[model samples]
Target: MVKCRALKRLKDAPPSTPSKKQAILQHYMCVSPTAKQSLKRQSPSLSEKVLENMKGFIHETKQKRNSDARNAMHVISASVSGEKISKGEKSKAARKLGLQPRRLSGGQRIRTSVLRSEKSCYEFTKRKTRSDITSDETKKQAYDFWISPTVSHTSSNKTDVKRSRIGPNEYVSHQIHLLEKTQTEVFLDFKAKYPDFKISQRLFESYKPFFVMPVKQKHRNTCCCRQHIEVRILFKKCMEFRKNLHASNLDLTQENLPVFEHLNDICAETVCDKTALHAQCLNRSCKECGVEKLSFNDNELDTSRNARDIKWDKFEYTEINVKGRKTRTKLMLVSKKTKPGEMFNHFKSLLETFPAHQNRANWQSEQY
Candidate 1:
């Protein structure tokens, strides 16, 4: 009725000169909202029903916005969370809250199956489930990024087998520097990506899974081990075994311990790998297995616990003769979760918003 009355007033305007009347019509066309959009005013009851529907639509929109606001959460298994939540309890809670689209995605959805054998490395080659990654260009780029063809080398040809396995001293020092650069770059990128960090006495609360692959001393380096133990045992006599081991990262002075001749005879290759010795990484690519053992000990090198442990590098497994029953296992430890840095998640939401091919394709790329 208000719109009708307003329209009537405009239509029933007083007479005016021809030019003035023409100006008034033009101004009214520019200003009158009803003139531009026809309004077939509804009956009162029908209008009430329409208003009720609009209220429902607005309520639904508000609810969806509230639900979406909590897209990411600090969640874990009940056991890990220290809460006894059964499947039923979770389902009941979900129902009570009217939660929609309650499904896990990305690496979190990866099944918790152990990769325990060398042959199992093939399983990790590509995480794509179906024919989503058909674009040859995309495939080529991903392959190149993951498996770059680069060969590591040493400048001097020290023909001695023992010294060859243990790199030259100059090279080791250079390697330590390289390690520093790699670790700093990667972690800085990680920190930038995940700005939300909470620190406590015993734990680091992060949105992404964080692991510091410990700097391992070569259990096999008799030269390193002998000199290290002598200097540590002599200087840090009060320190515990692990503390002495950890302290080796700081102590660089080569003590004038007796030049134990035939050190090779003492530190034989066989004795280098004692199962109890926390020297070498189980992963074969570990520079410890090579001469670059000191590099990983400090947070300087590319010390990603997951990077060294990637399944692709010369995958090997121990043939554990467990009770005379042979069990072959391939093992790989990877980041359990990943948080994209800053603006990346804005792009991430473009995929997560829909349940279509583009969304799934984006999911695969981000997860990779």
Candidate 2:
């Protein structure tokens, strides 16, 4: 009877003020469903407890994926042995249990490409067994195996080094030099063209040690003859082991110009050459009047003489002695310099025109 009377009095209140009943009940049972009426209206269905839990799970999953990617990245540094696939086992297991699989999309393809490139880099190296041979004597014995007269290729693929003296006809090459540049453009292009070889430039200035001629065959047990020397070079050519090119433009006098021959001043010297790669891009076939071609001939060298591949970037010159009597030899890159790296800019006012090197009269005269 008392509960029925209380419900009747609560229900008998104005229809608009149902909140009063909620306030009364909130004073008792703190977990009353109506206690969250305002919160429920603002955020329907998903309760605060469920939303907090979901947020924590998402944060944890993200951290785990980052950890996985970091660990996978390590595999790229070491030699691939096909053994790393098992490391993904845990990932496979977790994915099977309804956990969202970590999908890399476009990023994964990039990582895969990097791995393929690293593996293809060692295709040219000749693989050898550790127990096969030893020192200089054994090395010569091994050479005889291929140079043996009976071998069909002995007439073609013969190579003669220092060990043999009178086996056949052999010539000697000497002197070697190294030149390098600081510009990244030439190096970058060369690297892109030949990624497998060592990215090094060895500029040979003097009589460089290119190769030797072959003499005798293995059956004779002595070095090959001069007739065989030509054979050795042919073999080297076919193998493409030589560093330089067989034919390249050679113009060495373009650096130091003839400025009033008696003045002993080299204002400038220009070099010209014909090359397709350096031609203008207006039309791939159009080679004439191409600004793309360098003003100097730094590239396309003679492979027969063994000169390091040249792609001169900039032609450097600095007044060496006092009175600026002579200019010094400088380096150049295949590409031009940056604005900050340029030699000079006249339109922006002379860099040293502020009453420094040039007197007021000279500076004014030049300005006018």
Candidate 3:
């Protein structure tokens, strides 16, 4: 009875405030169906107002939710149709629709033309093997070229330094052959000769025989003529001095001017007709290819020191008494103040002193 009086007082108030209307709606919602009917009977106008406000609020909320869904759908459709939609906008739409950002759309596949162009631009060299070179004739040709006498020469000391067994009770002793030119130079020469031949540098190197090897410094003869050595050194120094003078804009006398400047032009024109070693040009005998002289400057040859005074050493086999037995052993023979010319004269004097029969066998047996 007390609640009924309070409700009556609220309804009889002068004007219906929002707070009063909200309280009345809350009360209607909390009451049972039978209680609601009783309340409606007591205040029919207040029940009608509460029902109308609830219906309008529900309608507006449903329209807003539907409009958000439509906008999200439009954004997704635009992205799929190739329209310019940024990832941020797409993610925003996805969030409005309550979906993961990445899951909003499927990724587009790359174009076939683009993939082809990428494949064409990217290059990789395939490794080559002996099997790739299937021509036996080509291999034979390369082998022949490498083993030619002009390209390489057999060592004079033919005693088998290395021996390898190929079969039972059979052995092969290969003679060492020294290469005149480097392997790379030989390959370049071969390529020049056979332009059609296709070969890699590695493959060309593999074709070299096991016995053939590069010449070492120790194998080279160091006993060069002193006169020739001095001439070469003088010429090199003159060339350098001439270059420095020319760079500094200094004038050179007629005698100091280069004499063989025209040699390069002459050789370029007649090189094809010349021999392999250019013997005619070197001999200065051929009318078409001879050179009279080659002088860099009018520098006099320095001849104050005796050529015989130059001390040098050479590797030679010397007969030595080992355990009272004469054994030939390799030794570095050092000659003091004795030039090659004097040594040759001494050898001739020894031959003249000994008889012809004794000279042939015993002369070489001497330690000196």
Candidate 4:
């Protein structure tokens, strides 16, 4: 296995950060002379492993200390209202709070609301899930917007106008046009010139035509907008295909993706029933009594601890022919939890199970 590079401790960390070996050597001074001699006496090569482990432990300790200091400083600063917070202090506080001081939105560094407590942040995030984009009616509107070749100003029907408080204005039209032609920075610059256009990001989603695909860093922001729309439509079709397949009780032998077989199956002792309502129960409902709880399952416990080790770059995608005159669809590659590093060709024989043209035809038939 490839080893991870050692993290530098804050004390030894410099403007020009020292290498792993240099950092380890610098930290060796903290070890008592007797302890160092004992490590050398155990085995000449053993000291290297001991030093490596020590380096990791020291780095973690430094990080914890820094975090504690930040939290204490924040609580003190927030409670003392008279103390003037400078730009530098404000930026530091924002970093500590896991917030952006100014986010680039609609072409400006607009200040976002700061939440004082974790409970407030959680509540704010929970409210965002109720966005109109997730509503079935809004999804139908989005589908209509997707099918239209050009964004015209003719969508003034009651359904379209009633969805958003601020209906389609000239500024919104201009913003959508900018999204089609330029990057986010250019769109923001355009909005800056028009002070009256005070549209929020949420408002943009309400007007279906104003939907802009985010430029992802994975593609270095060079993702083809046309292809992005095609893939998105394909994903929607895949969801429909999966639902129909499951409803029909059809076996998924050909389309089966790699998964943790053990994790998918419930433990024999775990079974929730009417009895669970009044008693300490098994079958996963009661964490204290459930047989399948992480405390009782060692494998699951270990997997949960190491799950975050999966790297973002390891994520893979492929195109497979799924329907209609060799029309292809994108599939995200997921690793089996049991054997995370094991590679297998699972999609080589999967067939086109859904009629793609049927959905496309339905969209085309709609009058916008």
Best by lDDT: 3
lDDT of each model, Cα atoms only? 0.30, 0.31, 0.48, 0.34
Give one digit per residue, the lDDT tens place, for model 4 in 1-368: 12333343534455454586576765775567976776668744786576555445434443455777555434433332122545556665445433344411211211112222223322322334443335444444333443234432232122222111122321111112112223334335434644454544444344333323332222122223333334333334333433544555555432341122221122222334433232234212355434322121122123344532322112346666765858555655434333212211111011111112222333443432
Model 2 per-residue lDDT tens digits across residues 1-368: 99999988867863556687678666645666665665567754566466555445544554555767445433322212122434455355224322332332222344445433322211111122234223433333323322222221221223322221211332222111111222243345444654653423321101111221223323232223332332233223322311221222233333421112210011111102222222222222333423232221222222333443322123334335544586665433224423221211211122112212212223343232
Model 1: per-residue lDDT, tens digit, 124-230? 32333333333434333333322221211121212211111112221101111011123334445434544553222111211111111212222112232222333
What's model 1's overall lDDT? Answer: 0.30
TM-score for candidate 4, please give it.
Answer: 0.16
Q: Where's the lowest-lDDT run of ten residues in candidate 1? A: 170-179
Q: How would the candidate models be sorted by lDDT, starting from the highest? A: 3, 4, 2, 1
RMSD of model 1 against the true structure: 28.3
lDDT of 2: 0.31
Model 2 is weakest, by summed lDDT over 10 consecutive residues, at 262-271
Q: Per-residue CA lDDT of candidate 3, range 41-88, in tens? A: 774488657655543543444345577755544444333323244666
